[model samples]
Target: MDDLTAPTGREEALRAMPHPDGTAPRALVLGATGYLGGRLVPRLLGGGYSVRVLARDAQRVAAFDWGSRVDVVEGDATDEAAMGEAVRDVDVLYYLVHSMGAGKGFEAADRAAATTVAAAAAAASVGRIVYLGGLHPDGVPLSPHLRSRVEVGRILLDSGVPTLVLQAGVVIGSGSASFEMVRHLTEVLPYMPAPKWVRNRIQPIAVRDVLHYLLGAARVSADISQAVDIGGPDVLRYGQMMNGYALEAGLRQRAIAALPVLTPRLASHWVNLVTPIPRRVAMPLVESLQNECIVKDSAIDALIPPPEGGRTPYRTAVGLALRRAEVDEIETSWQDADVLGVPSDPLPNDPEWAGQVVFTDVRTAHTSASQESLWRVIQGIGGERGWYSNPLLWAIRGWMDKLVGGVGLRRGRRHRDRLLVGDAVDFWRVEAIEPGSLLRLRAEMRVPGKAWLELRARPDADGSRYDQRAVFFPLGLAGRLYWLAVLPFHGFIFAGMARSITAAAEAADAQAGTG
Candidate 1:
């Protein structure tokens, strides 16, 4: 999963192609489990191409919801025998594989895979090869990551198959490594101090628009064979992207000071320290930032006109990404739980589940800190206790909820020091209650989706451990859109909530000692 965003140019390319429905034009997608390839497969299928996917883990490919409509072939893209078999009888081949993140000698591995695919495509007489690569100025010194991308394109072209290369910059969408980096950094840091490349110009495209262009490519005049640069309408610096993301999130102004001393290697390690993202993914992303990645030729635009519906603005793309994240959060099925490595049993101890929708946060802190003690603190949560911190924001959100058919803070809890399952506490309903260990709440207000707050605690070696989870089940597409739109804000609020709960628990323990 490298790039998650789809270029509008790819959609334009697909739309320009005639439908393969009746004749069932055979198409094969290598690396179908990867981010971009994950999206490209469905788009290709929807465009009426008979899609076959080649993946190292065929089970993962089979797990996708694309249904029985597509064929799943188990094979490593780099394997010559596998590549040959996968490309057999295919009319169009999409080379979406990359050797990065396989540890050292990734370039050599990438070159090998490209050569294998190209040779197989040529051998099979595959008519076209659509490849996605990076957008870097030709003839300039390239980063290892970008260099590998360009060389891969050359390998495919040299095989004598008519190749359509689509080179792109940053792609903005959920699950995209690049987009995730930006989203996490901008949302977590109140202000950012970055490397000098933050000032470098670049263009960003949306995943949806990219899907559109990929579908368009299938029908594009078979004669057009040159590389095309795909991008969104806006050209901005990396710094500007940070600022724009901040504004859209309704977050405070993100101040960034570009430092001369921070190199990409150092920055990648810094990224690992600040984010859950691994260093391998961050290094290539950061190194590429040293160059300006704005689109150069309008040749692609001229070849694939906006009238065919492939152009989208940067802001719109970002907005779509946020909304899509929210929607995905709500509609996320139990199948995703397997991928997330969540325990199958809902009551699994020491487990956590997270959900987000809009810009509000609600968490039920669970601990071995006795139900009475926990309820005491929860009942007195507002007013003088001040909600641990950020009472103002809590008050505002509560008021908003109240204005739209919610009890808000005014109702407080009944029987301030005790609670039972199914009992109503202010605007929250106790969905589950296990004395001394767990608490769960179901919201009674109008929201983007069905929402809940849950807490589970068990004794730890020291004293006790706590786990909190917010859950949302989206109603439809709108509900999903709502969850992603507020995902980052949820991260901030949750962080504060965790700190507050820990502090309060410690204080309560201290008070018991004194008494």
Candidate 2:
């Protein structure tokens, strides 16, 4: 090549580029609230980068504990104006948006979004564009999902923007849709009869390791605009992955019998039946399984060396995912509102109908206060009494639940003087009541899973310690959604319930002393 057309000293230029001294480099992460983006944002912040997020819901973006370290803007990636704003004055732009929501024209939507992002990055003169794509088997008929992932990468590459594309297959993590689907199916089903795609080879990556690569890619030289395939150390077929998951999750031994009659279209429905992933998301994933997802090269390993202990194995990944699931079982419940449909009025509170367990504790203290006086204070729990604490948050949740066709706090108590089975108690229903000793109520709100409320007054060393507890057990995919979505407010509501019960008991004692 002639000197005039020769490549410049890109390496020297990168070396000469300014560093952020003690401060972190500013990064703009589009779709920062998504599954991959969500995981990536925290790691970037930990690496000392001032991160910015662009998402549709400002509330959802704010919900993340990015704290004061990150900035969030509500913007759509496909819109030119919004995309330009999101990419402006950023060291690196992470394109993590994927249009997998099953509408009629998702493919076109996916291409348009990519094109818009690429054009926006080029126009804004962003330093580099980092994208994650899917690995597809060459020389084979590609499914629409895999084809669109590849097409999205091409759209960015053709835009003349320096792009670092990392192609990967299944990502194993606690909340990851793909990982959850695999976990639920393996745990719930004993013997497996799956589609022909069960034999297809796949390379799964741990979510932590995937986050590692993404963070490393952001700080690398802007000139390293190459498509790198990333995978875990192990390469196994879908059947093997299922076997490992079953073993890790403590399920009985399972055997897969591949059948020719099962197609991708049929497999999606089957996955929907067994896993928490809905048909809208399951269909695309099932279709992509038809193509082999084995990594073509180990270039990413060389770029960002694996940890000193070596990369996590597929079995280890399954173990970690299951452990996370167990840890997250409490504090939230998963339930999909769409799947449960609209709850009917006068819903039954039977344990068989609700699928919940109730625990109660009752104790008597040697106090001068009469039982009648104490019961009066307990009966008046909602409305003016307010929750034990965090009244504003409880009101907000009750309002939201009411808007969603649930029995909100407006119900109050059926009869404050007495309680019985199936009697309404504010937003709760009396599932069972043992006179003044114990009371159990089932939640009558729209939730991902079954929920319950229990009240018991027991004597303590000082006086009587009233114990009020709320418990939730999830149903399926929807149930998990319900739990995750509501967990943040749990501490506030639960603490309030405890304080209110204690205060109510004290007030009753004071009233009895006055009488």
- Candidate 1's residue-wise lDDT over 1-515, tens digit each? 12233444444345324445547788898766566776677667766678888865554555455736778777676778777888888878888766544447888878888888888889989888988888888668999989999999888878888888888888777656677678778888887778999999999887666655565555556677778888888999998898787777778768899999999878877675455344565678898888999888787765555524446777666666676565442111111111111111222232332342222355544454544454445444433354465666666766766444344554344233455443444456565566566677666545766677666555665556666677676778888887887686675666676667656776787788789
Per-prediction TM-score? 0.62, 0.63
**Candidate 2 Cα outliers beyond 4 Å, as residue runs:** 1-23, 329-515
In candidate 1 the C-alpha lDDT for residue 21 amounts to 50
What overall lDDT goes with each candidate model? 0.66, 0.66
Q: Native-vs-model 1 lDDT?
A: 0.66
Tens-digit lDDT string for candidate 2 (1-515): 11011123311122213355755567898766566776667667755667888766554455445634578777677778877778777778888777664446778888888988888888888887888888777888888878898999889877777778889888876656677678767877788888988898899987766766676676566567788898889998888888888778777667889999998767776776555455556777788788788889888876666644566788887776666555432111112111122222332344554545322222223333344444455555664455567877877877766554454564344233555454455566555565555676667666766677666655445555455656666777777677777767676677656655655667777876789
Estimate the overall C-alpha local distance difference test score of candidate 2: 0.66
Model 2 Cα RMSD, 1 decimal: 14.9
